[model samples]
Target: MIDLEEIRIVLVAPSHPGNIGAAARAMKTMGLSRLYLVSPESYPHAEATARASGADDVLARALVCQDLDEALRGVTLVLGTSARARSLEWPTIPPRQAAERINAESGGEAAIVFGRERSGLTNSELERCHYRVHIPANPEYSSLNLAAAVQLLCYELALAAEAGPVDDPTPAISEEDPREAYAEQIEVERFYVHLEAALAEIEFLDRENPRQLMRRLKRLFNRTRLLRTEVNLLRGILTAAQRQAKLARGG
Candidate 1:
């Protein structure tokens, strides 16, 4: 059973309040809830409410966050929306495939992260996601408004939900409760900060000339979608390394 409640549609740094409201409306129409706003340029503005048309409840309940990291908290699976090609190719899938993949998750929070209107998601931001979805559009003029992209993806998700179980015959791999619990996005961010500090302490990461080192690390870790226990274990290892360094320096 696909629990639509567990799906979260995230907007990253949206510039228009109206788009936010309209996106909420789209989600509501498709039987989806849980909208997360990551550092929108404008929100709670009258324009947004007005644009939402009749979905005021969705607008009122929207969860606003300071950044994408905060918006993705508790989300075990993250799919980013992007149109342009990147130097580093991620697991790219079409909208339908993205919806089906997310629908197949046994239980856990899944997020479809959309970017800003003008620039979309930056390369660094996209790296934080496990997969990226592309919406087919006219190649000559493929630029899509933030709200339109949300609507299209939500439509696909809605269709996938109503179409019954996916027909794929591949057996789902079993693990020790993959959905038991996952570390919040904030916890992951904290680990990255701690990891960077440790790397600097050991002279492995040069702050002055750190070029894409942290971004690469983020991709490496995000791919695994670390569980809460896994995060704690990694942090413990980080603390141990820090302590060892302190002892070596007689501090």
Candidate 2:
């Protein structure tokens, strides 16, 4: 059985009171009752109560903390939301992947950190997190509202916890298969290399102005975390295309 009490939703310096209330409602809807408000702009506001709807109990029981450190006192695992990639190297995972990790570590207390509505989490705040989570979205418009992000993440965690750990009933097929899985970033990098090579061969990449294009491409593929099979499929297509091009040129 899953323990909802092990999870805590932490809001850091929330600027809008209504978002706070709405987030609380979202948490409650997902069977997550614990809420920690870290230096919110305003508490006990009418907007918050109105937005909270019937989740007043969540707000009432919320722990108000002066800072994020205080709010994360006993948390064994911390997940922070970021819309953009940071310079610092941190294990970045999608909401669903993070949820799986959280479910596996169910015995320990965990916290999901949501930043202010406008600017989102700062570099300093993100540094405090052990894991960084970003919701998959269209690169053209990836900005997600604070409450919406919270709702999506909370929903994923709830679903993952309820489903329990992934059950692999099949016995080991080969001795080559490692006991652990590769990190998401390593998988992404392999896919990106294949994708970039394909694009270059097709003469699609602009050699003169490839800066923005690569960044946009990264955003596009990073959202999906292409599976090993998917990556192989894409590479195969590239190989076929290259062969066809060479044959045509020779003829």
- Candidate of highest TM-score: 1
Model 2 per-residue lDDT tens digits across residues 53-94: 999999999999998878877564578888877654456889
Tens digit per residue, CA lDDT, model 1, 1-251: 35776689999988989999999899989888789998888888999999989988888889999888788877767899999887667778899998897777655578999988888899867876778899999999999888889899999989988876674322343446654465666677788889999877777899998647887778778777677677889889988898888888888
lDDT of 1: 0.82
Q: For every candidate structure, what is the RMSD over all alpha carbons to the true structure, in angstroms?
A: 3.0, 12.4
Q: What is the TM-score of each predicted model, taking all chains together?
A: 0.85, 0.65
Which parts of model 1 are misplaced by more than 4 Å?
A: 165-180
Model 2 regions lying over 4 Å from their true place: 166-251
Task: Please give the range of 10 consecutive residues that has the lowest summed lDDT in model 1.
Answer: 167-176
- Clashes by residue pair, model 2: none
